[model samples]
Target chain A: MITLFGVGCLVFLVVCALVVARTRDLLAATVVFAAYSLVMALVWQQLQSPDVAITEAALGAGITSLLFLLAIGRTRRTEDEEG
Target chain B: MRHVPALLLLLMVAYVLFLTMAEAPAFGVVDVPSRNLVVDRYLDPDPEETGVPNAVARIIFDYRAHDTLGEATVLFVAVGAAAAVLVGRPGPFATRPVTGTDDPILRTVARLVIPFVQVYAVYVITHGHVSPGGGFAGGTILGGSFVLYLFVFGPGRAARKLSPARGEMVEGLTALWYILVGLGGLLLGASFLANAAAGFPLGVPGKLLSGGAIWLIGLGIGLKVAATVANLFLHLAGES
Candidate 1:
């Protein structure tokens, strides 16, 4: 039997991932993805791999988000009319 | 078009996650062969073999110092590449003058915290053999402090203290130092990064100076990674 808390966390991670996929603004999507990584790190910690949790928090939450933000800064802003 | 591949990738990831969960080991059980090996032999080795208080540091810096050297080199390369891309333009300086109003509250907080942040960074690096964190974690924190400086003081002021060229030099030298230590083992007829095999003394376990060549390797990696990440952000902020 799945606990309510586990179900809630899984749903939240799914929602965050979907939002990251659908967001039009690249920077906003990067932030959302960072949040998703944080949730995943939490799940990893709950699974009792604190070392994996730390790596996820560092690489996923920190460096991956920074890389995305930098890439967004380098590129020209997407035009609203281009869709 | 582009979204097709991304969507497919996400689906594949979800499928993999489902499969992993389905086949996952029971909670608290050791399943993987490597995990079993590590738990059986090394987690709390006999005092004769692992002469250290912190087993993580002993594993990372003493037994696996070559991997640490390689990790530092990776960061050094990243710094070099970022500098080359961001600072290599040859036209007359294109930097914009700083014109934003400085927030006194932020500045005051930064002034109060920056010293402690730096001190903690050094302490974390030095005390790797006795604690939860080692060079990489401490180095990331040090890099984060510089990022905080960029956020509060603006890129212009931060750049004066940490120019891209200087950061590149520090990254290069420290990376060389890390690699040279590993190479020293080779010269002594042991495999690279063989701390005890290279004749360094693994001092009393819990002391700051113990763990043979681990502390030296940690210091080199800490300096190199901190400079590399700082340079990465500085270049991205266009201060290089």
Candidate 2:
């Protein structure tokens, strides 16, 4: 069951990564990236590195998303198409 | 086609990476060279040597403290550089009176939830030596609470609670405090950041007051990180 969960997390991570890369809506991408970080934290915990897991959850999911949200708030929410 | 060359390059890079991975030692194998005597020295000591039951904490706060200090310096410098770029500019960093929401639900929930978050952050920092979390995790959480406050109550009130000047003061002083603690080891005839060897008492391993300089250093790092995070948000979000 644990192995299944870990595999599911990896699959979800790949999907999130792809969506973040493809999405033009920067806010949506940032939210998806936060989900990616959350799952990555869980993966770290499953790998028995709880210390890394905590850091990942805080730094990756919490603070980074906030910073990105602020940056998005200041700038355009959608990416501009290149000429 | 245009895509063919890019695809070929990608394949070549992937092949090279796979070759490198094949050459590397297997993960989680005990007999690997990566699992050397140094690893054993850290793991097998039973917490008596470092007085930190958490091996990860022992390694970071005690065995390899200089690297941790370097990490702290990096955070400090990054914050400094960000402030330099943001403060003097006329864009996002411009001072503005915060427009706090009058939403009663947000105000009520924030009032109710923020204290518990602060308390949990304290727990993560103080119990670091014996637990999973240490300075960085706890400090970010502490900062996150302040950020939530800023989000709900706005920067005017948040600034009153932790002004930019006060935040900078806390950041610098906590860093200096970490160095002062390290200097104590040097003054005692041991090298910098020496814990047990410097003649400081290492109490019972599992206790809160156990890990000597480890505990103190963790506290300093926690406060420094907390200040750094909150200050960065205040700057980025605009302070009153």
Candidate 3:
């Protein structure tokens, strides 16, 4: 049962990662990346490492996304043109 | 066609991970090589020797202190680089500030919740020997609280409490404090970061002030992380 649940989560995580990579909208990608980190935190919790899980949740998901948003707010929201 | 190599790389990574996972010992097996004598040493004799009940804290701040010092230094350097780059060049962000939304709901909620978060952060750092939290976690939460304050009260008001220059000094000092604590061991006739062997009085096990240099190390790390995160965000947001 746990394996099934974990597999389901992994599948969802892969989809989220793909979306983040493929999407051109910077803000949308940032939001999806945050969701990916949340799933990663859950995976760490399932692996029984609460320390890493907490760090992943707080820094990886919360603070990192916030930082990206701050940077985005300062800079451009759209992707630049390729030469 | 464009993603062919990337897809192949991903497959290779998955294969490597599977191979690694296969090498791990079966779950619930205590006799595995991964569960070596070092684990036993920490579980049995280390607590008695160090008087730190939390094995993670002891491992990080006592047994492997040089690594912790390195980690703190890395954080310090990262913050310095961030501030230098962000603050040195004042771009469009400086002209028209992006943050500080005067939403009363955010202000009211942040005003109510920030104190508890900051207090809890302190508790986590102080009680690291008895709980799951440590300097890193506590410091991040503390930093988060500061960010909340910036969102609620705006950078103009927040600067009154802690200016960016002062934050740089604090973070640099905390990094130095870690080195000084390690050097204290040298003063005690032992190597750097020598916990019990360096004559540090390990108070009663599981006590708040116990764990000798571990708590002190945690304190330095906690403060350093807090200062770094606070300054990094402020600088990135063009407030500093």
Candidate 4:
């Protein structure tokens, strides 16, 4: 049962990663990347490794996403050059 | 054309990972190699030998202290590099206003929440021997609180309490403190980072002061992590 859930999560995350890679809007990508990190944290939690799960949730999801969001906030939202 | 090798490399890496996972002990297995050796000793650790109850914290702070020290050093260097890279910019470092920050909701929320978060960080660091919390987790939380403070209160107020300079100093001192604790072991004719044998008192188990050098090391690590991460934020976020 847990294996099924784990497989489902991995599949979802791979798709999320691909979407983030393909997305042109840098801000949207950053937000999606944060969500990806959060789900990854959830996977760790499901594995019963609370130590690793907490670290991932705090650092990966919380701080990393915020940093990316802040950086994107200060820069262009999209990759397109406006002439 | 160029994508083929990258694709092939990805497949190769995936195969290696798959094989490794396949060989791993089945989840929830009680008879795994990991649960075989040294697990019993840690489970029933002699209080006279070591006061710490939690095997996770005890192992890291006692058996594998050098690794933790190395990790702390790495974090220090990483934060230092980030600060140097970000703060090297003259305009961002200088002209950014250091004060007069007031977003009403953020300010109120941060003011209400930061103290509790900081208290929890301290609790996690100190209670490591009895719980899932430890130096790394606690320190991260401590640093995170400061980051939250920076976002709401701005650099000026945060700097007043813990500037990048102060952070560097704390990290340096804590790193040195870990070394000093290691040296204490040598002083007692024991190996570096020696726990009870280093003459550190092993009080009765479950007490706040019971873990001897483990708790001390955790304290040092917690302070260093907090400082390093907060300093990292100050540097990266316009250093106001």
| Top candidate (lDDT) | 2
Error at B137, model 1, angstroms? 1.5
Write candidate 3's Cα lDDT for B1-240 as tens digits.
999999999999999999999999887677987777778877674478888988788889988898888888788888877776778687656655655877889888988999998998899878877677789988888888887787668777777678899888999888888888889999999999998899898998977889888988899888888888888877876675
True contacts kept of each: 0.03, 0.59, 0.46, 0.26
Residues B1-240 of candidate 4: C-alpha lDDT, one tens digit per residue = 989999999999999999999999988888888895577776666655578877778878887888988888899889877876777675533443334357798888888999999999899888877777788888888999998888777777778879788889999999999999989988988889998888888787888888888989989998988888788877766763
Give the lowest summed-lDDT range of ten residues in model 2 chain A: A74-83
Better of 1 and 4 by DockQ: 4
DockQ metric for all predictions: 0.24, 0.59, 0.53, 0.36
TM-score of each predicted structure versus truth: 0.78, 0.94, 0.88, 0.84
lDDT of 2 by residue, B91-196 (tens): 7435343456799999999999999999999999999999999998999999999988988888888989999889999999998998998999999999999999
Which has the better DockQ: candidate 2, or candidate 3?
2
lDDT score for candidate 2 against the true structure: 0.89
| Alpha-carbon shift of residue B9 in model 4 (angstroms) | 4.0
Model 3, global lDDT: 0.83
TM-score of 2: 0.94
**Candidate 2 lDDT over residue span A1-83, tens digit each:** 25899999999999999999999999999999999999999999999999999999999999999889877876668998951
Q: After superposition, how far is residue B208 of candidate 2 from its true place, in Å?
A: 1.0
